[model samples]
Target: MDCGPGDEGDGSSPVTTPTRTSSTPGRPSPPAEPSTAGRSSAAGRPFIAGQSSTAGRPFTEGQSSTAGRPSAPARLLASPAGVHAHARIAARADPHGRTVLPVLDGEGPLALRRTRATGPAAHVTLVGAMSGPLGGDSLAIDADVGAGARLSVGSAAATIALPGQDGAAARYDVRLTVADGAELRWLPEQLISVRGSALRVTTRADVAEGGRLVLREEQVLGRTGEEPGLLHSRLTVRYAGRTLLDQELTCGPGAPAGWDGPAVLAGHRAVGQLVVVRPEFAYESPESAVLGESAALTPLAGPAALITALAPDALRLRHILDDALSRLM
Candidate 1:
């Protein structure tokens, strides 16, 4: 089924159509007072005032498509035949050191939402209104952290990227720019890759000498009783003009034979990676951070720490990663 997800629109107004069930339900229930719900969080840090946007709505809730949303000057998508969409966000810090989200825009099925601030970090989540990704679908998130600022990014839940009938693959690309003396914690929970789905993720991070990065990526090949899809993920990290980590992993139904080996994922169905760009973060050898015989962590060859592992499911992967992150600076 080639579902184009209708015409794409920038994240400038409210969502009017009903949501499809194929996409995960990531939105919390409507708050009592919608105006003050943007700054709502269930953890440390005083709520610094914000609002939650829906898969169709912009950064403001209860507002019409043209009534009360921030004007996005740059919008794309000039056709209705393709499924490609784009979402861009810019973040900075106030004089008090609190992170602030300035730009959040999306066009197509993919949406961007800014949730509450958690522990001095601005929280943002991506919501897909369609059943999932179709062929040629693209989503990009760009974050610019000012000097001395801190940003934390999280997904409400897992994203399922399903393949379309056009023989084309879906893509999700993220670019992060950490300024001097800044930090960013990207903790995306998981991505469920369905069978026959060709999904590729390119994550590029440019960190300053004094900047810090604690990034994590969790991947599940397929759900219970399902065959694995095709997943090709690449990570490129550079600090002060030097490449710290540049690696790529490809597997699933379309992978070449002899790709299965003990040296690569073994027999695990899920995988996770936790990368710390700065040496200041405390971390032990990947061999020591073990969940069980089903999961193992191995550090990528680099000057900085690039820890990657495989597990049986998302919960176990998260457990191992959470412990690893707790030990970081």
Candidate 2:
């Protein structure tokens, strides 16, 4: 049977007789063959109509079709070493209606840009821009600092979040390598993990002999409203194969019942940590207050400086260190 385009086998068309040519006087003419190229043709019908070509065999759609469906999430790998300066990482919805830029910075003066969003849950995007906010749907950052290169990291506004039942989370892993005689100053804005939210950050720095690393991390919790605590954070710092600092803070339900003890938080709400490692660096004793006030300072037994603060709030702790950092610079 001859089939044309746009025709289905409903048996509505009239049958047409086939023309016959005799090859030999005694042999009957062979049946005419059907065209196999068109969808209406029998040979192409099975494939185009989504039917099995082989009898009793089922047809299976592979990745090309299944790709449209949302499946389980796949694991993804991110390397800060591969990113250039002034790059965006990720952005997401927040209770406060503001955008969150996880990581953003570069390797020169004005190496980092800071900005704030207007509304609650605003869409944040990161693009490679020369000026203005570096936008991204997720995180943003610069992972590379050439040998002997200098860079400074900072954020523009206090990241805020609204109250919500379901918690939010973010993770940052930064690896910095400073060659001999090089210096790196990393001063990122405070991270605000509002009540009921959780955040985890890990930073590793590899510095050669004679290299200098100045680093600071500030976190605030429950900025918008009153809550037991604003953040639960864990931080680890290492230098030249020696562990410089290992600290963890868990507020609220699982917080240490004796956190008010002299050895613990001493009933303070906000906390900050700063570590500076250099071959020949000098820091006053824990008795020397960081903010000229009667603040608490804990000095490790080795060549690193570790200071902890219990401020009225996370914001206070952030500013205390910000002022201290300006002096160090």
Candidate 3:
């Protein structure tokens, strides 16, 4: 599949046809193959500003923000205090069941923009108003979907984590809440960890019994040929007050031994995970199976499914995740 620096792939490739291992007694049929054409090849494409951290950089003064957006104030961008930013989104349903955003608040480097939607679901795009998540930075995003509402969240570009003057690790937190009868899709771009940077990210989802969710996360250990710095990530999800999935990953210089060995990343640069939660999954869940060579799909204890994959590059990683999502949904 072709995923240009600017395009995130949304189609499938036949090479990733899953190899099933087991099935449950009462499970729905797997999703049919998506008929969309495969994307073009992303090989040898140069990294743009948002797709990478070191774009056009010599760490000199007067550098511009990615995508022509205005950079943050000089004091904030260069301050030794680091950045503290938060963005919040609250979506509710109208009497006629149309989704609406009553609260869209963004601060510091995290900017939220409402975009035109193709359906009833309210869509939001996260814009990186400034270069960030540098070491010592603290950022968080909170989203709430009320009952019967549908919301889809995406980012304008990939996030690049860079080194900071303080030598402290950057922190990012995501909190998502899905009310009963509501649906949410959190599909952001990849996060690239640059050399000399340290970053830690956590994502938690609280889903009501009848709520539905589809979340995707992708991490690129380092830009093209560079060595990664330090990265740690954790994900937790609860459905109806019960744990559905909880996992953690660490990589780079300070990670546990052999993290890049065969059993783990196996030298892959891009790693990703996808989770889908639906009430119907309680009655019918996908069977444990291997999708392609680098990805796996398994049914969770509740009405959820998980997909984990690794790839040589962000393009391929998104292909594997997108294929798994198509199969699950």
Task: Tell me the TM-score of each prediction against the true structure.
Answer: 0.74, 0.51, 0.77
Q: List the residue pairs that clash in candidate 3.
A: 2-40
Indicate the worst ten consecutive residues by lDDT in candidate 1: 1-10
Worst 10 residues of 2 by lDDT: 128-137
Global local distance difference test of model 3: 0.73
Question: Over the stretch 136-167, how does candidate 3's per-residue lDDT look in tens digits?
Answer: 88999999999999999987668888887658
lDDT, candidates in the order shown: 0.60, 0.40, 0.73
Clashing pairs in 1: 11-106, 15-56, 38-50, 38-51
Best model number under lDDT: 3
Give one digit per residue, the lDDT tens place, for model 2 in 99-125.
333333222111222222232221111
Q: Which stretches in model 1 have alpha-carbon errors above 4 Å?
A: 1-13, 18-81, 279-303
Best by TM-score: 3
State the displacement of the C-alpha of residue 247, model 2, in Å, after optimal TM-score superposition. 1.6
Scanning candidate 3 in windows of ten residues, the lowest lDDT window is 17-26
The per-residue C-alpha lDDT of model 2 at residue 149 equals 39
